[model samples]
Target: MKKFTITRILMLLGLFLISSGIHSTNKESIFDNIFTVMERTSSAGNLPGIIDNAGANRGAGFNGRYVFVASRQSGDYVYYWDVTNPDAPVQELNISGIGGGTFTLADLTAIGNHVFASNMVMPGIFKIYHWNGIGAQPSVLIEYDSGTARLGDAFTVMGDPDDFAMIIVSQHGGKSFYVWAMENGELNFDEPLVVTIDDLPANANFSRVTLPDGEDEFPVVSGPAGVFVLGEDEDIILTIEQSFFPGWPMYVNIFAYEGGRYFAFMHVKDNPAANVMYVLDITEGEDVLEALQILKNGTFAAKVLHSHDMGSIANGNASVSMDVVIDSFGNLWLMGFAAGNGFVVQRIGDAGPDGLLLPFMETFDGEGEDTPDTWLPEGWISFTLDDDGEEFNWYWSPGPSANPNGQMRSQSAYQDDGTWYVLNPDNWLVTPQIYMSEISGDEIIELSFKIGTGAQTPGFK
Candidate 1:
């Protein structure tokens, strides 16, 4: 009787362990094919020629080549940088003579060669300063003095400035927002269209008001409670609960890349370590509503494509601005700036589902022993979580003493003249996206691979 009882307990324990392992794997696999990774390419703070005003950096804007950063003080200046080589950004221009009356320059947004900055000169008196391009003299595009509404806490511009553009600005600490239209380089300063949202948290200052180009009908706003999509009737069409966010949502934007549409936002909290920037793939839906609906239903864990730890770089009000730019080489990049944290540039990888045909195989047949160390087969990715810069990644290796054809290989560490040098290999090699749509309900799939190591000591996992 005792032996039988012990055996039963052991069996139950084994089953529980197996169940836990399966659950963990399933949770991880859900994000495997849906999200991309935000690899930080460059970041710098307090560089020469750039203002180093901590906690005063209010906003940033990108016009293809240049990234403009503005300080939120009466006499502070707006600086621009040329990040052609993200690794080494060069400060190009700085404009002064901004800010007056009650508030200084609060935020900025750029489209094409045109840049716009906002300032609330006095109570209910808001002015938008326009620049044709960097180094161009600023002109007052629109000045409205009405009610007790406050503008310029956060704003965004949609459409092409060369053709037609619409500027959306939020009333600070209020539920109402204002919009203006510009066509053929002419501004219509006529009475602005004011839309008021219902159930907006009291004293909730909008951190961002984004209207994706050509999607003016559905505008998105980020505030204290969460991020919301406002419909034509000023109703909250969709809501991304604040609980889903890592911190208070401060900035949000949408962009398209590699035939995929993505939504990204930066959040902040009292603990700077809690701050993070997240990106999600919205390409599964045909339209904005459909994409957002999928995201709302899928929950945060399932839809998040990427997350970058902001660390202690941002805190306090944590006013941040982000913009997406496509380089001349057609690579997509996300540029971000926080008042006290400076700026960061990350290259957006193509991690969306490719829906490639089934039975995919990568034999690494074309690789030779002499292949360049940095070469990687198309669609394959290699990266390391550590910033130590010892990126000794997996490379093509001609098999030893067996098959002549090459195979992918990685070395844990190396010994030089009796001295053991630890590489501390914390790396990942990801395969290309594969289609899994054929797997139906209750279907089982298998992934098989051959892995071996030349060393006697254990390394590969």
Candidate 2:
């Protein structure tokens, strides 16, 4: 056509690209949108402390602006962070000496102001701590010493508004549940409220707990690798165990209470060879019934592969083992450990039935980055979004660029004055945008992209 310089044509195309990207400009403000998470943690330096290798810890919320985290670096101690500010989480206090002689690294639980933590050891020591609203350090609330008793590994603590909180030990030398009571962090009950396979709806094949040689007992007392509590209801307890039992089978069991009968999903382990995970459901009563056959699911449980095998990856290493939390809007956000994998924030609650995922509140790596690299390894990271209750659509950069699909849409996402907010698009009728609201609000801000859409699509698949 007419004589147009390359620069002029490129400018026109750029403007058109920007214009086409703008769908609409209409806007609306809908408040009362809140999200919930289960567990979250990060390396040292995320919080304020002279302690090197101190990581960010997260769990269910408590009080006003504090969170219960499974502290990583410091003997897996539990610490409270003031998240009222959301971004700059400052350490309010710390709890230590929960039983193990060495560094305690495991899960933690909290109800109201009270907290609990555990580590791997025979007759392991389960420690408790309490935060009293006012300025008080989290002191040792209680310590449940497993002593020489075959202790459960990877233990988790859960409590209700009532008096007792159940400590679900994945490997209690047998199929059993330890129930403990807390009178402001003090263990009120003496022994665990033992729920085993023998007397319930079924019988647990604890043969793995005993060695084949017969000389030594293969006590099911290996530590619970992980734990999850489905609300405060006495309905069901989701426990994940990592033990040498049954040939070191990593298990995921769901002990559900229905009517008066207890149904269980027993003995799940990840197969290294096939890169797959096998899960089974069992029931308790006169005999331990294997309800479901071995169901094979994705083998992403192993962080080594999940973080490395896929292009877009998620790392839920909150030290709590895949802590999946369903939010108020029914979005499931998992907070645990995310190392070199930046795709975690992108997926958020993408696993639910309706293409929705839980919203991530915060993520960080202690000690600022040494280099300004756009990756997960070098820096501390965290994110919070205004989810409109819609299954957020994943958007890539420029055109067809590869980026992890996140939970929400954006109208404007500029970094100004350090505050991130969504703004109405330039021309779209209902356009939305996000930008930094306050520069000093969130400590670590990360933005990344991937290549594809839908769960079946392949970018991080």
The candidate that achieves the highest TM-score relative to the unseen native structure: 1
Model 1 residue 37 lDDT score = 21
**Candidate 1 lDDT over residue span 203-254, tens digit each:** 4465566754334456677866787887655667788777776677767786
Clashing pairs in 1: none
Clashing residue pair totals per candidate (backbone < 3 A): 0, 84
Q: Write the per-residue lDDT of candidate 2 for residues 1-461, one digit (tens) a residue.
A: 54332123223433112111112111111011222222132222132342223233322223322454454544444545543234544453444234453335444444455454454455556554445542455555445676654443344444332444444554434554444444434556566554343322222221112110111111122122322222112222332233322222322322221111111112222332111112222221222111111111212132111111111122222222222233344332322222221111111222432443322232222122231222221112222232342322322112223235433222233344855543322211111233334557558644432322221222121
TM-score of each: 0.61, 0.37
Q: List candidate 1 stretches off by more than 4 Å.
A: 1-54, 72-74, 85-97, 121-124, 202-204, 212-216, 272-274, 327-329, 348-461
Evaluate residue 174 in candidate 1 and report its C-alpha lDDT on the 0 to 100 scale.
74
How far off is residue 434 in model 1, in Å? Answer: 36
TM-score of 1: 0.61
Q: In order, what lDDT does every prediction score?
A: 0.58, 0.31
